[model samples]
Target chain A: MSRREAPLNRVVMALSLVATATWLALPLASVAPNRIVPGTAHTATDLLGWPLALLACLPLVALMALSRRLDRVRCHLALALVLLLLMALPGWLAIASQWLVDPELPQARLGIGAAWWLSLFWLSLMLIELRSRLALVGWRAALLPVVVATAWWLQGAWLGSLALGQELDGRRGDFLEAVVDHLLLVGGAVGASLVLGALIALAMRQSPRVERLGFAVLNFLQTIPSLALFGLLLAPLAWLAARFDWLSAIGVSGIGWAPAFLALLGYSLLPMVRNTHVALSEVDPGVLEAARGMGMGRGQVFRQVRLPLALPVVIEGVRITTVQAIGLTAVAALIGAGGLGSFIFQGLGQAAMDLVLLGALPILAMALVADALLGALARRLDHRRLASPGGAP
Target chain B: MSGRQVNAWAAPLLWLSLLLLLALGGDWLEPLLRWSEPDARRVLYPQADLLTLLVRHVQVVAIASGLAVVIGVGAAILVTRPGGRDFLPLVAQFASMGQTFPPVAVLALAVPVLGFGTWPIIVALLLYGLLPIVRNTLAGLEGVDPAVQEAARGMGMGGAQRLWQVELPLAAPVILAGIRTSVTVNIATAALGATVGASNLGAPIIAGIVNNNTAYILQGALMIGLLALVVDSVFARLLPARQ
Candidate 1:
């Protein structure tokens, strides 16, 4: 490496260090009652382990920068080294912060801390080394989930201090005061969507008479805006209430979780139902025929052969639905469904960036986690199918 | 083969019948029977006719989708370049992130920066619409037979010319499918414009929610759903048969 290149390497590391430090310090400096990172809780930065994490980044960042100066393709190998260092930094910092800070102040659990740091380091390495071709068999497969999980976990740990556990009156942690309130709203909507979607798919598959109707219904549902669905549900909810006194109490204040959940479910039905049908149809015809030939009943063949073969694709559809649901659920907050969306909308109203992050971070975490978990499940199912009794049929 | 074809034709009709039964609840057979109260008409304003509401919705979706097509195609092209393949997945992943989040959140986030109404919704719709178009475009281009590409190159076609004349035409069917998906999703998502106070079909639905009016909700829902079906069917018919 040239002498000039060495100096530039130093500058990049210096810049990253400064950025990390400023990121750490600025939030601390502006400690407000309802800040994105609440002032009272212990963060990854507060642990004794945190400083080691910062120190750990130096070598990797240095290697990354210095390696860039070399034209030899072998320099790309430095990324593996840098990746290891990045992984080590966060845990070191988290541990250090834990050691140095007050024990009583809700610090991140060790598992969470390690996972959090490991992800950050890996993701950073990936981002920096994006231009290079660094392929590892199992590692590339493992890389994305680890990064997403750690990123989300850290966001949770940070927000946990700011919002989670703290008791705020009138307005809850930044969005609507009730976390469960939002969870139920979003959960019910999404859950109902799954059920309805499955039903629609099944119904459409079973009878051709209703296939077009199912398609039409799904197509229609996909077209109406989530906001419009919520609005549409409101009237039905209200009508049910007006007609029956007991129903009214439970149903339509038109501003609560019921309409929101129903609307989300309605919007979700399209992908779920349509994907289910397509996935089922895509099942290998030979496998299904064999199942039928084996004296398996129609129901048995469907449950064992068709569903198993279609499992991966169907789950993929669900994954799409869930991710879409998470976002749509946020809109539910507008009708009082109460998840992190409440914080975003509230922030918009109040013009508070902190509040927006406070809510948006959690929803984002929920999405990342849901996607990761579902992806893992999908992989497992894929493996099982590939390793079927017949062997890679 | 003939029996299977008959079954195939029969199966779709059977499914359609079942769904219609579920939707109408035997109202076809028992026309005299009234299972529920009659729904009221959707509130039609002097300024906002049905045609007007539809026109506005179409305009917003078209503009947003048009923008998305450009961005998606550009991103796909950029990522497919020799150097970009390594990082293309990451870019695609981030673009998917934009889709995964609620547009309402985007609308809310944009409200302060971009201010209220259709523009924020438009931006959000475009952002949300990017993933499918880009992903499909990349897949469609990649899926083109390499032999054809090689022959074109051998015939002295440059990269640009090959892409335009050969690959793009081959990819057009898949690309159109992607565009169709984006447009459909955008049309539905555009209804979210009502919250930030944009004028579209969401107008009646939002007003109905506020006023506890089922008629208004049904009107909008029914219309929007019908429109989606018609458009999807139309496009499905338009697509060329696979060879």
Candidate 2:
């Protein structure tokens, strides 16, 4: 680390320390503020024991002392790190409470709400940082937040909160569990939809007739409303129950995950199929001809030439499918999928904002994580031909 | 194998076959293939003919998708102008905000002021569809060949004429493709219109869920899905093959 890096790292260290302390303190603070020692409770927990807060001010303080400290990257690093710490403050407070207070009491669970708020706070700050960086640097950085917030809010409004108001609540645990549930539902559904969609797209590629059928099927899937699709799946699913004992045994109960997952899967197919077909079709004509000239059959040409070249576009389709599926999965909650959407509906019923927030936060985080992780994968795949040392045959 | 004969015969024949299969053998297929169930609510609605539903949904989806295309394309275009590049990302940011905010939330937020039905659904659909439209339009227009544009200008066409006659026509296929995407997405999203009281196909779906009638649910779902497929295929047929 350079001279600037040192201060930046120190400030970051201080922030981390403060955040850790605060998160540990929140549950305890919620319960027995007095029992945890006077200074240790709030004073010691005041953002990494006061020194860190002062440390937070150090970069700005140093900027005044040294004219050269105004470098752009340095300023950005300082700002981003400090904001990251500030965002982490609530969790730190929650953690501190947990460490200092009694665990068995109901009040001690303030950590739950605190942790929730902190993560949200962190997300908000990251968003702001992302926006500012976009303003300062360029637009590509803006992609993550845009995709994330869209996925998040779409889920919050549609699934997690059912267009209900958001507020602070103790139901964060339930919301977290619901979020995990959504990930499982959305992850599985989208994963399968992508596979099925790719297969259909691939099948369409096999012949003009198949292509036309794929086109028709995909179109049909795209036109139907999500809520309607869920409804459609129910009857067929129920029919399966009538025909098969196992299906009846495992069929939707009052309302549950199956309807939601199936609906999401159906909704995702259009984009996945269309994008795959277009991508595969667009695989350089010359490349296909070259493969054929080399005596490679259709299957070999597709596998060796077309599919690999089309992977990036197919991935793009999957990216859209995944993001859209996350949003649709929230609607699945209407069918009793029991994800964050459950709270959204409950909040709508009760007219409470906090319940909505408890549910919405996790969905937002999931979108962010998914976008980040998958986006990284997509970018990596984009450069696949270059990564392989030898030139294409 | 002739291209003209293929196009002439294939389109109508396919539609006839699909319709005939769906209508005549539907009862038998119901028991055998068992694709979906009959909807009692659809019977109650009285105005369930394919044309009426199509026209109504087209109005809803068109207004929504139209607004999305204009705003999305406008923003995309505006940002590329001089002194506008910095704000290009901002446009994407805002559009993403529009998207992530959820159409339902937009509906909820709009309903207080916009007050139920068509307008609210339109606004929600517009916002929901903006991202794809704007992104694709920008990509399409920007993707145009500079040499063609330079030649257009070199031939004495002014910026406006160049854009209208040359650039736009060249970008038409891609931009229209984006429009097609927006339309399809809006068609599906318009289903949520039922929540705020905009009449579309969502009514039967919601009703099916409320009543625990699998047939009803399947009816609504299958119809919507089929509608989407038909519309998508139509759009695909309309699109000129990519150069």
Task: Give the top-scoring candidate (TM-score).
Answer: 1
Model 2 lDDT, residue B191, Cα: 76
Which structure among the candidates has the greatest DockQ? 1
> B79, model 2: CA deviation in Å?
1.5
Predict model 1's lDDT versus the native.
Answer: 0.63
Q: What is candidate 2's lDDT per residue for B115-202, written digit by digit as tens?
A: 5577878887888888777877778778889999899989999877887898778877888788877787777788777655676666
RMSD of each: 10.2, 11.0
Docking class of 1: acceptable
lDDT of 1 by residue, A1-393 (tens): 554432223222433455454434322211233333323333435532467545644554555465445333434545544455444444443443434344465532222232343345344545444333343324464674476457545644433332222323225544444556656665676677777777878888779978898778766566666766666566457667778887666655556776776677776777778778898888877877787777889888878777787888778878888877888778777667667777776775666554565566567667766776777688778888888653322
In model 1 chain A, where is the ten-residue run with the lowest total lDDT? Answer: A26-35
lDDT of 2 by residue, A1-393 (tens): 456432222222333344444444453223232212112224333535657645644543443332233345654554554444444434434444545445454332221334334434433443443346435433455454455555444433222111122133345567568768878988898789888987897688779998887777766666667787766566566666668787658765335777777778777888888888898888667767877888988788767777677787788777777767766776777777787667655654554433544555556556555655566567667777558722346
